[model samples]
Target: MCYQLVERFSACRCLYFQHAVDPCEAYRQRGHSVQEKVVLVGYTCSRHSMRWSGNKARDSTLSDSGYSSIKG
Candidate 1:
């Protein structure tokens, strides 16, 4: 039997929101504005779920030999 499946992934960039000031007294001593744009970084990871047969007994009866093999 051949099994087929599809997976989905999505990502979006966030717009600039706010600025912050450094209170360490180092940036202030340099006489430069410490305000900076907030940047967002993201990623996606996936786990697999088998599509078993509709019949519970049939699903259970299927051999486990190739069940764990993954195809990207």
Candidate 2:
């Protein structure tokens, strides 16, 4: 029902532009649907988490506590 063009630049972030464009009711006319096409606007880390900075801190070795550290 609408055409959405997503735009974003971030090291770690997932955002959806709320501005929805009017879509042609017929897929043949428009060529794509929101459900069929996905627009991802962010970055994902190893744990499925967004990166907070452009340069992510290197993860250290993990211990039995499920944490990464240089000295564990």
Candidate 3:
């Protein structure tokens, strides 16, 4: 039996990282079966995560300044 770990970003479902394959005697054999373990990270990747937080901060600031009437 072989196992491969896949890590993904929770928000955008993007491939965040991958671990090395844990190979066994049956690895690469004709009838080999690979077990995949997927892990969803708690947060989004750095790129998108920062953008989301920044947007929240900006929105809050706008609301606090009595500018909520402004529409996109």
Candidate 4:
């Protein structure tokens, strides 16, 4: 039996990558005969992935510096 490797997106389960094996003629005779070994990537596909907004504010405080004034 011949086996093929398939990589898919973890989130959407979309086809990301594939490695095909040189299957024998007997295997090709039957439709969809190649055995698929599915390997899920850690990240999602670009189309289904999330994007972070650059315009969002990091902090609401007026001071950007880490240190604050210590009043006695």
Give the alpha carbon lDDT tens digit for every residue of 1-72 in model 2. 545565332333344344455566664554565542334444443443433556775543222223222375
Can you tell me which runs of candidate 3 are displaced by over 4 Å? 46-72
Worst 10 residues of 3 by lDDT: 58-67
* 1-72: candidate 4 lDDT, tens digit per residue: 678888776667889778878576677565657788887764556565545469653432232223222355
Q: List the residue pairs that clash in candidate 4.
A: none
For all candidates, the clash counts are 0, 0, 0, 0
The lowest-lDDT stretch of 10 consecutive residues in candidate 4 is 60-69
lDDT of 1: 0.32
Task: Please list all clashing residue pairs in model 3, or write none if there are none.
Answer: none
Give the per-residue lDDT of model 1 (tens digit) for 1-72: 112232222222333123334344455355544444333322222222233566542222222223221367
Q: What is the lDDT of residue 62 in candidate 4?
A: 31
Which has the greatest lDDT?
A: 3
Displacement of residue 71 (Cα, Å) in model 2 is: 51
Top candidate (TM-score): 3
Please give the TM-score that candidate 1 achieves against the real structure.
Answer: 0.21
Better of 2 and 4 by lDDT: 4
Q: After superposition, how far is residue 10 of candidate 1 from its true place, in Å?
A: 9.1
lDDT scores in order:
0.32, 0.43, 0.65, 0.63
lDDT, candidate 4, equals: 0.63
**Model 2 deviation from native, Cα RMSD in Å:** 13.0
